[model samples]
Target: MADENAVIVNVLDLPIEWRHNITPYHEVRDPDLVQQLRASMEAHGWQGPPLVCDRDLYEVNQDQAYTGSHRIVAWALAQDDPSADMPCVFIQDIGEHYSIDLGELVEENFGNTYAAVEQFVALLPSDVAEAYGLDNG
Candidate 1:
């Protein structure tokens, strides 16, 4: 909903003041995804930390609580696994200002059958939606 797309800033770029752990959003991964990611990691090693943020991660927008949490939890769980310790980069203080385009968000969630962009967008502030030219209603 934020006008500007979620800027993929370097993990190192975030402010020190923003660091905080609200805990990862837990989910029982589908066996297939776990297997697939496991295989990918075996061959490539942990690519990088999953994009994440602290409790106050949202800026112009809100609701990473629902959409962005899983991405972090999956990476954390993977890292904990004895087999594949994928080192994940946990982000802090991100939100509408950090959000990428709706299409980009959808693409990031590619494997999922349903579109969460609309749902996330719905949770964004009115100003955020308007910024993205999405709050037509």
Candidate 2:
């Protein structure tokens, strides 16, 4: 579950100099997947927010993306309209949270990364989910 205490912030409202500090554990985003995400945003707009760490955690003023770098990029590319806000969950103390080990949960639930992706993709809109070859069922 998403943290109830998360501070919602518009992605574009973040400091211009603040970089997206992606963790080493995160997979390198596939270009094809990014394109699909861009297309999805263009067609139906962003569905959910990404998890980002507070800027105070970094000495260089970087915002750590706990998840959703692709979505952020796709949002910016699909629409640069200032009024289009991408409300992201900005967590202040992610280290203190118990929900960080997604790998363990994913392995327990689906037994593999590919299955986990499909399962999550199914949560999106019907058409978007179908594009990824997964049904809501």
Number of clashing residue pairs, candidate 1: 9
Candidate 2 Cα deviation (angstroms), residue 79: 1.9
Error of 2 at 137 (Å): 24
lDDT of 1 by residue, 1-137 (tens): 11121233333444322222434344545556666654554455434333342233335332233322333344335445422222223222324355634444556678341354455546667664453333432
lDDT of each: 0.39, 0.45
For candidate 1, the TM-score is 0.34
Q: What are the clash counts of all predictions, listed in order?
A: 9, 0
For 1-137, candidate 2 gives per-residue lDDT tens digits of 22233233443243222233333214436777778877877777655434443343346644544456555566556665422334443332222232334344367676664454444444445653342223422
Regions more than 4 Å wrong, model 1: 1-23, 55-92, 96-137
lDDT of 1: 0.39
Write out the backbone clash pairs for model 1.
5-99, 6-98, 6-99, 6-100, 49-88, 49-89, 52-91, 53-91, 57-94
